[model samples]
Target: MARMRWSTSHTRPYTLRQRRRGRERIQALEQQVAELRAQLATQWVQAQPTPGTRLDTLLTLCSALLVTHDLPAILQLVVQQAKALFVGASGVLLFLSDTTGQMLELRATSAGTLPPMRVYPGQSTAGRAFLAPRAMLMAGPELALALDEQQPAQYAELSNLLTHWPPVSALLAPLRLESQRLGSLVIYGGSRAQPFVPRDLPFVQALADMVAIAIVDVEERNRTTQLASQLTQTQTNYAEIQARLDTAQAQLLQSAKLAAVGELAASVAHEINNPLYAARNSLYVVEQDLAADAPERAFIAVAQAELGRIARIITRMRDFYRPTRTELEPTCLNEVLRATIELVHTHLRHGHVTIQHELDAQLPQIVAHADQLRQVFLNLMLNACDAMPTGGVLTIRSTNEPGDASAASIVAIQISDTGSGIDPEHLPHIFEPFYTTKAQGTGLGLAISAHIINQHGGCIAVASTLGQGSTFTIHLPFTPPPTVVLSMYSTLS
Candidate 1:
């Protein structure tokens, strides 16, 4: 075995002095190490987040980011905070360009004093991190040692650039979501100490996630609020229309009741007069044919005829009061309309209202009460006659709708009076009950007409412009009236 030689043999005379210096150096180093440990402890404590609150915060931040339209502002703030948090070398935030053909663009950088600002295409190491999006660490002998052995010139170049600002051994974390690279967050550790170690990878990753979620959440909230406001506005409009409808319906009811009364009055007059006239004629005939001594037939015949008239009057009265018993059958609208016109012929003749019928042959038969429908026509014809005090064209037309098969088979009777137009504002409420524009009119005729027609599954509408005359259109539902679903509320116009 070779004898071991100690180098201290030459310095023996100075041993005590060296020992004293060595002890002092040890004490100083120990103190410094203790101070450093305290600093590390503080940093560790600060790093701790609220208990189990990370996920909740991430969720809230994500929601906020979705509503933010200005991603650039969010990115700026993030980068600024990152600089302080990392306390590492200078950082660069690189963003992707919109154009697919172009390379990545560095939107901002902390290296404010570098060569006049320039954009870097997807080519350099920073670009590689952006493209690959993975955290990278190279320190100790591995870095310089690799640089020394691999490519000294390139290593020196990279070293110089990094030293310019961050001034350190470094760690680079790719800023990205999934595989899509938005940018990169580069941290600087001064030459004396690296900013991060392998232990800190999780924190870097967590920070990156928070930034991504925050950006997405802000944008979404803004969009949701805008949509909600638009929906609210739409609902408001619908509500206004509903209010108008409520008022219109009340008017319809009043008009319908008046019209029914008017028809009843007219029917009663006709019924009563017919009997009175027939009985008088029967008496005259009996007087001329029977002998005074042999038969005395005038008194008997006149009395019998009067009784018949009384019976007829009572029947008509019953019909007028018991309107609910109107017979429902498949009635052709054309027949009912013709009958109504004939019944009101004298009235129209008196008013000088010319009747025009343009009944479409295509309309199918409707299921309705014939007499009720006849009354509806009578009311309309009479109104038209009244409108044209000096004679005007009253056109009635019927047509079938091609679509709406269930209701398509339609009969439209339009009673247009060239006398005078109604106000536009009143047109929409014409179907409402108790509303009338005529004098000496109960206002119920039109409303009742609308109600009766609607009960038969039809609709009545009026269109008029002041000074342009008015046209009342009746569209009878092609389908038979379904069994009325009885309830506390009555179905009316």
Candidate 2:
């Protein structure tokens, strides 16, 4: 025998072969273990909450969404429900962006102490998901490493959130509505929290979808509220316009009645003039023929006086029925107003009424028929005196006022009286022919005044308080109608 000394070399082959076999077995065992681990992970993912269960929870959340009209409350509830679903998540953060997507904003977060943070689409996990509009996840050291890789200057503010609550894992999903990503939702799991598996992603995504729907619902509701308010305002404005139109139509009808009355008065005045002249001549002859000492002379003188009064009344009727002349010229309204005041001074004195002038020194001249304007002012002053009866103050003011876009400017004339104001029920009819409240009034003064103002391309408005006083405002544009100017020029030529 070669003895034990030869044994080291002689058994080396067997030892090497045995060692190689053992190493092969070990590698095969490791491969089987990795395959088994993969299979187990797949089964664990499949073992997550059933579709029916997810559907039930989703339905419950949707019911809550339907009743909850508040947007912030809905978002809070969504995050809270996501925390509950994961069972061990530390908190959730919601990042929303405007329609333009220029800037991302931190909207809501379930974690009380988590500092707010925002990132652009190319930066962090939240941003990446927003770009892809897909779900993403990171666990433990991997999340920390990714965050650290970001530039120190740009991500300095973001470091505090990670330092304060270093999550063991995080899951994120984009909140999308029909291919448009509105924002992203992030769920953070603490060190002791359960890992959020793949199956849980669907549930999280569903929550995100619910959030999208809620956002749209709230926006649409707000829009509807605004539209309703606008519609109500429009309806109110339409009612006001309709009321004004009705008033204008009534005025037009009254004007037609006045026109007819004027025609009748003109015909009647023509018929009465001849008879009045013959009667006046007969009275004069009778008075002349009577004896100087005869008692019949006094009777004849009284008859002549009565005839003269009748003739004066006929002359007034003729003036009232005369057609208005269309000739207009630029005339100073103050001069016309003063002339009118002088004519009515006697009547004002009898009524104990005082006149006050507030004429604007810089008041520009306006295109007008001076004679017609003077007549209009005379009628207004006489009417004011009648209204006072016991006496009061009359104020006349003039000023320049801005006009509409198409007009250059306007001259505003205001006549105010401190007297017993017209009754509200009677005010509207005051400008109608024969609608006077006075016992001896013909009721044609205001109607004729209104007609004259209208012919001048002006508008008149009256405001009265039953016991307080009354004010009549006249707005007249500075320029006259082209036809009036042309006709005047033609007549002059």
Candidate 3:
């Protein structure tokens, strides 16, 4: 067997990159401190500060300005310190919106007259250090004049706008707040001096952090404003929906009252019709008797007729109050459809309206509460008739509905009218108790009918389009009509 060779894993040794970077950064910070120590050392003897330097000064000052949510103010202070110390040049601050992000936004500027109007981060030696976030100092070829003159067109323009006097050398560094990387700052040489040194990274990093904190503050302000706007919009939508619901409820209530009155009137009129006919015939007979010179007979006839009118009125009162008993039978859906049409025939006298029928001849027998179904169908037909006040097509249809493996079958009675359709806004509340569009209409007829059909295990659905027309289809199951059961024991001989 061949001998197998195996290798042991060894941890990789630390590289010189991190070590060298640390040493250079510390050296840079010392140089920056040495430059600032002369002036800052005197500031320890606290003097009467300006209003902006009072207690809670930065917070109060930042809150007063809406600039970048005041993030720039914080960036400004960081760069100001660098300017105070490194009296050699002007500086800039830039921030990254997030770590590992592409965006680099210019946040602050230092005291100086810039070279010209130019795109930021021009292809200069200082621009390179800013992009790399590393320290750099140039004293030789890096300060070549011909190179600076042929700058990126955009940057050259921005440089011209920035200053009447350009710095000879500059320093660039990044700003970060906690995990978020805000941006960076660039400081250029004030007089004809060499560019920043590699030893400047430490001081630059510290200043970067202060700028980052200000960026955090500004972002917080922006978020607060957005949240407030969303809340206001939400509240407005809630109010509008609530108003529509309330209006719909009120309309339904008024509709119920009209239906009740209509039902009562129909019953009274039926009862009175009979007695009125008898009285009219009696009057004709009395007139004939008076013409034959029998005036006394005519007077007796008139009195009897007067008494008959009173009896008719009382009978109507009794019928109106009595509960109607419905007969359950095997009723043909088409017959019910025809009866409903006939009931509303007298109401639909407009010559412009056309009646259409498409009754399926093979419809199954519908075992239903006949009288109640009649009343339900009648109400629907009348509603459809009323919709077409100026005369339109009233279509009545009936068909057998397919059933499952159950005891009985189902049928559908559909009434469609080409009349003014319901307003779309009222569609949801149309079936609600007492909702109606008619002026003299009590919205209750449909509501009561809906309830009765529901109790009988059926449903009514409506489909309407404004200006087109409306259709109401009632679904009746083939369940046997329920019968009242009474428990009574009797003895029979």
Candidate 4:
């Protein structure tokens, strides 16, 4: 009410003072905001890992690879480390099928909820990761849009986990090296606060690469160890075989030496026999010419008696080297074996060799040279006696092989000895000329016997084992006897 004179200039001075205070307050508030922003920037720098620390973590993951060769163990480790690096994410390591590139196997997982499952390369989040060369991120409707409805279950399982966890985003990185697509590393965002970002893709991809390298190294090492074991076994077998061969060669040389000595003895006996026969005849004539009471006649008679004894001994030696008849006849093989055994019975008893005959009485007659066949058995018997210098059994077996009407009838004769068995190496050459195992063998006996049997359409085979025994098997075909020739003079008479 004191309408006294209102001074506009005084009011202007108060208004200007208020405006100046307001500007000072605004400046102070702006300075405080700038300081807060700087503090936030520093905090962000501190929170993020340094390149060196991140590299060390990656190296630590790589070092873990050396500890195991198992594939599942390696992949589990990879997923665990990936979840730690990518904060608030559940991840899986998938392995691609070598045969079908479309097949994706979820080998390992960071979270334990997902059972081991298989998915297709074009059908699910893991599949798309495998198909793509670089890292990719999907969020919201993109996950559903990219999924193949035809493979609903595989993609659906992924959807269900996502819905339950309700991740804000999902990321995928390929486990690839050059052209080889090993598999994919898949991660789903676990929370909105720590969602998967574009910056995280490179680190996930780097981790995938390290895992692929470890897989290749483990497989190569397993293959190398297997090959080395196989090579060592092969070498051991080869050495054992070589040792046996050397033993056989030494036996062969011993057999050859005995045959040479026997040949020399036979030749010397043949040269001495003729002269000794002439000397015995002269002594016999001198005994007849002298008087009965003469002293010289008595000396000549004694000389003739000694000479006759020498002749009988030489005849026995000649009989063994004599040639045999070549005529064939239908004869019983068993009878021929018995006769040959009789001839050598005295010598066998002297050498302490026992003969055991296992004759097949039902055996059919075979067309053979009786004299020659007998000689063959006799030679075998003598050889058996020589083999058993310390005494053993000589087993002889004869059997008729059963056959169809159209097939040829066969006879199998086996001569076995429980003597110092022929060396396996020497057994093969037993029928070769001048090859023998005996100290006094002529070596022509088995060779000549084998020839005769072969001429009669037969085969002979021998089997022996060192320190065990030997068996000589003879197989002969049944053949009819030859026609006998008659003289015209006999017919006229």
Local distance difference test, per candidate? Answer: 0.60, 0.75, 0.59, 0.72
Instruction: Summarize candidate 2's per-residue lDDT along 359-461 as a digit string, tens digits.
Output: 8878889988786677678887787777788999989998988768786788988888888899999987888888899999988878777866776778888
* Preferred candidate (TM-score higher): 2 or 3: 2
Ten-residue region with minimum lDDT total, candidate 4: 481-490
Candidate 3 residue spans exceeding 4 A from truth: 1-207, 214-331, 342-352, 365-367, 400-411, 423-439, 465-467, 477-493
lDDT of 4 by residue, 264-304 (tens): 54676678778887898777777778788988987777788
lDDT of 3 at 160: 51
**Alpha-carbon runs more than 4 Å astray in model 2:** 1-57, 112-117, 139-164, 248-260, 292-431, 434-493
Predicted structure with the largest TM-score when compared to the true one: 2
TM-score, prediction 3 = 0.39
If the candidates were sorted by their TM-score against the true structure, best first, what order would they fall in?
2, 4, 1, 3
The all-Cα superposition gives candidate 1 an RMSD in Å to the true structure of 16.9
TM-score of each: 0.48, 0.53, 0.39, 0.50
Give the alpha carbon lDDT tens digit for every residue of 1-493 in model 3.
1232323434755469855766677777777778688656555324323333432443443344334455545555655666554545444534343334553434445643323332234344433433554444444456445236444773554355334245565555545454444455666654553345555555555555445555666677678777788778877887888888777766655455435644665676677768777876776676665756676766767676666645543432332223233335677878877877776776776646678889999987766656567768878878887888889998989888787777456788888999899898987767655577778876656865775566457788899998999999888887644531010111122
Residue 113 of model 4, lDDT score: 58
